[model samples]
Target: MTATLIVIGHGMVGHRLVDALRELDRDRRWRVVVLGEEREPAYDRVRLSAYLGGRSRAELSLVAPEFAADPRIDVRSGTPAVHVDRRARTVRTADGDVLRYDALVLATGSRPFVPPVPGRELGNCFVQRTLEDADALRAAVRPGRPAVVVGGGLLGLEAAQGLQLLGMQPHLVEAAPHLMPAQLDVEAAHILQHGADRLGLHLHCGTTVTAVHAGPHGAARSVTLSDGTVLDTDLVVFAAGVRPRDDLPVAPALRLGDRGGYLTDVLCRTSDAHVWAVGECAAVLGRCHGLVAPGYRMAQSVARQLTGRPSEPLDAMDTSTELKLLGVHVATFGRTPGEDGSAIEMTFREGVSRYAKVFLRRDTGALLGGILAGETGSRADLAARVGRPPATDLERVLFPDPSF
Candidate 1:
């Protein structure tokens, strides 16, 4: 008899798990059921900003037509799994349907975090997370009007650029002292800010949004900053951060990590042996990965275990990142500088548009971590070189010839 595997939450990672199972389950050992809360099918959320750039909903879809037509796979869009009966090994949906499963997986992903400031519930305030959120932002776009984007991380910067593409004057508000404080060092952030300035993007760093004041019609008219300054705006887009969606009702409450998310063992199994968790919702080894690559790896790990294959743990997952924000290329990889100041740090810069920094261990000269701003021609090569010594001369690694 074929067993049933019920997957809750149909985001990118959930879809990936189903796809992996389909490829590995050659004997058709298990039937799969996917529950998606959103009405729309799985789409490329990483390229969600492309929606503002004139990409249609169909263009960003990640679901293959053949996968949808698979008889063994059943995908229920717009259906949210409300509760889990661990003892009975069943799932309850919002539509009053109960699903029995031999094994269960939670891939609920996360929800965008909006700070608890006054007037945050105003009419024009939004969060950039799902395709629906993107559609809402696009519908509210008014060219030539001022818009405020909170947070200076990757998502915040991307939202600012998207607003600019929609012909809106975007003012980025970051509580951090500089942009991308978590990823880039001060010098690298300076170079990135210079590039953003050249693009006519307004940045308000070292401050927070105290409150948002409403207009006569009750929409967001202006915002008060922590520095006692108020700026007029048309809308507010909060791309601050995200929290795992781990509040699903379960008979025996699942273990959670210190920060947040379902605490999973090395094999991505939750407290329950029959249950598994993946993606942003699974804090494997008590740590949650926000990047897509790590999430994809976790999904694959779960699928491998279900198919009776050798499953690999996510202990060595790479956390490196590279992206272009406000037309400036930036990348960061490997371990950052240690707090004790043991790692040797080297930096190079030419003009305001370029900067690079690399950290190396004093004893072995092995690469520890590095940051790049402006020209990221060596991102791929340098990221691969992480944890190992440079293949060529140190100077060449830091400052490659532009002619090449």
Candidate 2:
């Protein structure tokens, strides 16, 4: 007899779960049903900013025709799983239909966090999340219009750059001392700061938007900063951060982490044995990993468990991040800022701006952490050496042959 497995949310991580299961479940012992809330199928959200650069919706899609054609996998778009009836082993949809399943996986991902500021409901205030949000932003923005992007983190910088590309005067507001406070150290952030300036983005650091005042007809007119400065802008895009989507199913039996997200064990199994959670929606071992890499690992673990395949236990995931912001290559692997005494630090620089920093274990000389800016061609090799001490000398490893 075949078992029914219902997976909620068909985003990248969610879709990967389906892919893993389909690859391993050769006997077709399980029937997979993926439910997505979006009208369109899963798309590459990481490249969401590319929408401003002339990328079409179809180009960013993660789903292929094969997923829809697979007989073992049923892909349901435009339908959201509203509630889960654990007692009856069924899930209720938005149209009031119930789906019976022997196992369920929650991969609802996360939603962009909009700060609670006055007049936030005003028109022309947008978020950088879905394609729909990008479309709305594109339609609302006009050349010469001043736009303020709240937040100076990864997504915030991306939003600012997108607005700039749209011919709007972009202003980046960040409460932190520098941009990408979580990822970059002081020196690297300064380099990125210069890049932002070169891109013509107005930088407002160490300040927060106290309130958003609107003009007539509910359109945003200007934003008041914490420092008592008011900047007139026609649009505002919030890219502060994202919180996990934990409101689904309404299952009282489901456990949530302190900071939100479905609580799960090392196996990605929730309080209920038959139920599991992955991606941004899951809080593994009481902590939620927002990056796609960790979520992908979680999906693999869960898929292996359901397929009765032996897999390694989910442990401390490598949270190293590597991405481009405004055409600048930025990467931080292993540890970003290791204590001075705990680790030996080495630094390298190129003409005025490019930089690379690596931390080695004080006693053992193992790679502990690093930060790279402007150029990061060796990210893959450096990332692989993380945790394990390399046989090569620290100098040789850091400054490897460019040919290799």
Candidate 3:
């Protein structure tokens, strides 16, 4: 007799869980049911900005035709699971359908965090999270107009670049003193800022949006910064951050993390063993990782466990990241120097175009973390060598000789 596995949400991580289960469940022991809130199938949200560059919706899709056509898998797009009945082992959808499940997985993911400011509900305001959001932004884009993007993190920078690509002048506003404060140090962020300036992106760091002023037709016309500077703009985008979507109606509510996600164990299992949580919605051991890699790992671990295999513990999840933002290369891996005051820090710069920094343990020379800006050719190599001492001289490792 086959058991039923119901998965709520169909974002990248949820899709990954189903894909992994299909590969591991050789015995055909589980019938899979995936409920996606969005009408469109799973798509590559990381490159969602590419939609503004004329990339078709089909191009961003992550759903494989084979997986979609699998006989054992039932995908219900646009169907949102609203309630969970743990006692009855069932899930109730928003459309009045109740699904019975031998096991359940919550991959509801997250929602973009919009700062609570006056006039935020005005038209022409957006959050860069879904394909629909991209479509809305694309429709609102007017060539040569000004756009304000709140936040200077990865998503905010991406939004600004997309606006720029659409021929709109983009002004980035960051609450932090520097861009990507969570990942890059001040020097590295400065290097990235220089690159953004070269690309014609106006940045206003160390300030927050105090209020959004409305124009005619109730659309966002301008934003006032905390520093008393006001900039007129046609649109406003809030890319500050994300909060876990863990507001499911459960009869016996599951434990929640202090930071607001479903608290799960190392195995991605919630307080109810039959119900598991993965991706941004799951705060494994009271901490939530906002990166896709960690979510993928969690999905993989849960898939293994469901397939009767031992699951890998997520105690030391890797948080390495590398990306090109507005034509600037940036990468960070492991614990940054600021994350640990005891760590030894070393930095190097090359002619204002490149900067690199590495943090090592004070007792041992083992790598703790590193940051690279302007040049990131060594990102993969350096990330792979984390937790171990450099094989060569630290200088050569961080700043490889150009002659070589």
Candidate 4:
């Protein structure tokens, strides 16, 4: 019998799931319901900063209009699921619309983590996670306005750059000792910090914001740090971190993680048998994979399992990620600093215009991770080649002396 598939959180990963299930089972009889809180179709969250930097709303569409309107998919945007009837296998929406599903996929994704601080509720304080949020931020941006982005990670840096484009001098603040602390080492972070300095941004590392002061119009005007240093800024964009949006529609005994994602099995199944959770809200193998790939994997696995077909176990990923921060390229791949293994690596660069770093397995001579700030793009291939037979050309590149 064709089962009813209801997936909550219709963002990028969720919409991809709708497409994946259709391709996997083309019978057109299975009911596909995508419930979303946002009022628009699934769009790219990675490019939210780009949108804030003046890209039109139409540019970020992951699924085209015609495809999204296909008869097979029922996408309900702007209406969020509020309650879950575990016993009846029904999900209730905010409008009290109840849906019964044979298999429910919770793609409830994550939200920006705003640490509880004074004046967080101020008007100009914002979190850049959705297109609506981006639009709101764009509307908030004005000429010569001082802005502070309270995180130095990818999204935070992106937000800082976007704010610069909006004519704001953005101050990037991180409680960590360095920028991209989760991804880059101290050396790489220094290079990135230098790059940010060159981009007309002010940097604040190893400092915590103690309080936020509001202006007369009810917007944030300044931030006081733990060390008593104050930064005067009209806006505060908090990109510190994200937490899973798993607040609604859950039964008893279903526990949330320390980091706030819903706990799930390797196959994306939650503690409940009839339901599953995917995307940023799921903790897989004790990891809350905030990236999109794993979320898509979870979606695919659950869909296949419901169809009685065996799904392939995903290879443990060593994702090599890169981004052009302002004008400088920053990258990291495989095991980062202190990731339970020692690194054998090499570094080279002539000047500010050139740089490279390669990490290898200490004893096995295997390429573990690499960073090329001003040079080439071999990290993706390196990640793909990991744990697989080295391709001929890549092997030659990694080990030119093939005779050995």
Candidate 5:
């Protein structure tokens, strides 16, 4: 029997599943229908901030024409899934139509988190999730305008830099004591802070926005800081973070995970055998991975299962991170140095800013955590260095022969 596969939200993971399905079959037994809530094609959400800076809309596309016209795939745009009826194996659309599916996959993805504070409802205020948001942000940041971005995390900084390119004096505000508290240690964050400061970007660490007051026309006029200072600005971006989107109603057949995600088993299958959930909307093996790589893996897993092939369980992944910041390479991984580690080796060249440090369990040869700055040219190599054995020899493993 031909399987009717319905995938919701054609973002990163949704698109990957479409690709995996095409690879599995040349025949037409499997029917793939993708419902994209957005009005346009699936573009890279990871690069949306770069789009605000200078990248064209076209550069963000993942699956272009040839993939779109595939015989087995039918993509429906501007269609939002309002509710899911699990027992009946049907999904209701905002247009009041119901579509039946033999197997359903929910890849609704996450949305930028905007905390409720005064003036948050202003017209010019925004979050950078869709292309429309990017367009509005670019318009708000006109020549010589001032802007403040709440949250100094990766996306927050990226959005801040975008405004900088548009001739805006960008101020980054973070409630945390250091930038990227979830990703970087205090020392590494200091290096990033210094670098950003050198770029003339004003950073307000350990502060919060008390209110955003707007002009009578409803555009953001100025942001009032918690410390009783107000910065006059035109653009106000909120890039605090993203959480799985699950506000819509779901059919009883779809089992939502603990704390609101769609629950999926090792194979990415939901409570019902015929239904599966992946991407930001899923809680896999007790952890929610936001990066694209793991979501891509889940897409591959489901395709293999449908094609009657062998696939591996989505195993535990280290919640580490590495990304470009104003052209600097910043990476963080493993445990923090002070926690559960016996000894920590810190290396720094005084004149130069290169830094490397690693922690080893006091009694054993196991690797606890490590951080690399400056010579971060080896961020990937260092992250991959954590494995079953204590690095063969910490220094030797840190710097291996390039020839090997």
Candidate 6:
């Protein structure tokens, strides 16, 4: 008898788990059911902004062509899991169907945060997260119209660039003091700010959006900043942040983090042994890492255990991220600043062409973390050195010998 397993999401991380299980579970010991809330199957959400750059829906799809054809896999798109009967090990769907499962995996991912400001519900106000959100933003863009994008992080910067590509006058609003504050140091952020200015993006840092004003026609007209400046805009896009989608029925029974993600053990198991959680919805060791890499590792760990393979605990994870925002290359691998006080920090810069910083153990010279801006060509090589002691001549790597 094959065990029944139900997965509550079909996003990138969820699909990873399914693919891993399918590859390793050659015995066909388990039957899988995937329930996706979106009508469309999983797609490359990381490249969602590319849609504005002429990429189509089909190009962003992450679903394999043979996935739906698998006899052991049952994919129900547009179906959302509404409630979980933990006692009965069953889930109730939106269509009044109850699914019994020997094991349950919650991969619900997250929802983009829209601030509760006045006039937020007005027309042309959007949040960038899913393909649907991207479509809405694309339709809302009016060439030569003014637009304000909330937040200066990666997503917000990407939105601003996308808006610019659509021929809109894009302005970035960041409550923090600098762009990519969490990833880049003050100096690195300064370089990025310069790049944004070159791209013709308006920057409004250190101010929060207090409220959005709407016109009599119910469309967004302007936004009021905390600094008492009113930015006149035809549209507003909020890329502020995201919170895990933990509103399902199973949410109440699971232990959640202070910030609202399902608390799971290293094995990705919730309080219930039969129930597991992964991706953005899961918080391991009380910390929820929103990056895709960590989420992908979590999916692999859970899949290994379910397939009766040697499962290792999710111990240390690399939270590094390398990407180009607004066409400006940026990479933050390892911790920006080492937590230990005994770390030596080095910096290098050259005429806006590059900015690099490295942190090493003061005594052992082990690489801790680093940041690169405008020059990420060595991102892959440097990122691989994180958490490991430097094996090569560190001086030559940061500053190549003139003789060589």
The lDDT for every candidate, in the order shown, is: 0.90, 0.87, 0.91, 0.78, 0.78, 0.86
Q: Which regions of candidate 1 are displaced past 4 Å?
A: none
Q: On residues 1-404, what C-alpha lDDT tens digit does candidate 5 reach at each position?
A: 67788998889899998888888865656898899999877889888877887898789988778798887888888988888888888888878888899888889998888988788988889998899999988877777767889999888888887888778898889989998887777777777787787778889888888888888788888998877778888868998988887666875645566766777778888778878888888888556677787788899998888778899998764556677676556666676555544565555332224445666556554565676655444656666555434554555555444476
Model 2 lDDT, residue 93, Cα:
91
The lDDT of model 1 is: 0.90
Question: What CA RMSD would candidate 4 show?
Answer: 3.8
Which prediction has more favorable TM-score, 1 or 5?
Answer: 1
lDDT of 6 by residue, 189-241 (tens): 88798889888899999999999998888899999999999999989999998
TM-score-better candidate, 1 vs 2: 1
Q: Write the per-residue lDDT of candidate 4 for residues 1-404, one digit (tens) a residue.
A: 66688988899888887887777776665778888898887888898888887787789888876667677788888989988888888889988898899888888898899989898999989999988788788888887978889888877898998999878999888999998877777667777777777888899899888889988888898999877899998889999988787787576646677767777767777788977778888876556887776777777887787667798765464345777886877776665435456866676553565455666677776766666564444567666655443354543343234254
RMSD of each: 1.3, 2.1, 1.2, 3.8, 3.0, 2.1
Using TM-score as the measure, name the better of candidate 1 and candidate 4. 1
On residues 59-177, what C-alpha lDDT tens digit does candidate 2 reach at each position?
A: 99887787778899888899999999898889999988899999999999999999999988999999988988988899998899899999999899988888888899998999999
In TM-score terms, candidate 3 sits at 0.98
Considering lDDT, which of the candidate structures 3 and 6 is the better prediction for this target?
3
TM-score, predicted candidate 5 vs. hidden true structure = 0.90
Worst 10 residues of 5 by lDDT: 346-355
- lDDT (Cα, tens digit) per residue for candidate 1, span 155-254: 8999999999999999999999999888888889998899889989999999999999999999999999999989999999999989998999999899
Better of 1 and 3 by lDDT: 3
Order of models, best lDDT first: 3, 1, 2, 6, 5, 4
Each prediction's total of clashing residue pairs, residues at least 3 apart in sequence or on different chains, is: 0, 0, 0, 1, 2, 0
Clashing pairs in 6: none
TM-score of each: 0.97, 0.95, 0.98, 0.90, 0.90, 0.95
> Where is model 4 more than 4 Å wrong at Cα?
337-341, 387-404
Candidate 2 local Cα displacement, residue 230, angstroms = 1.3
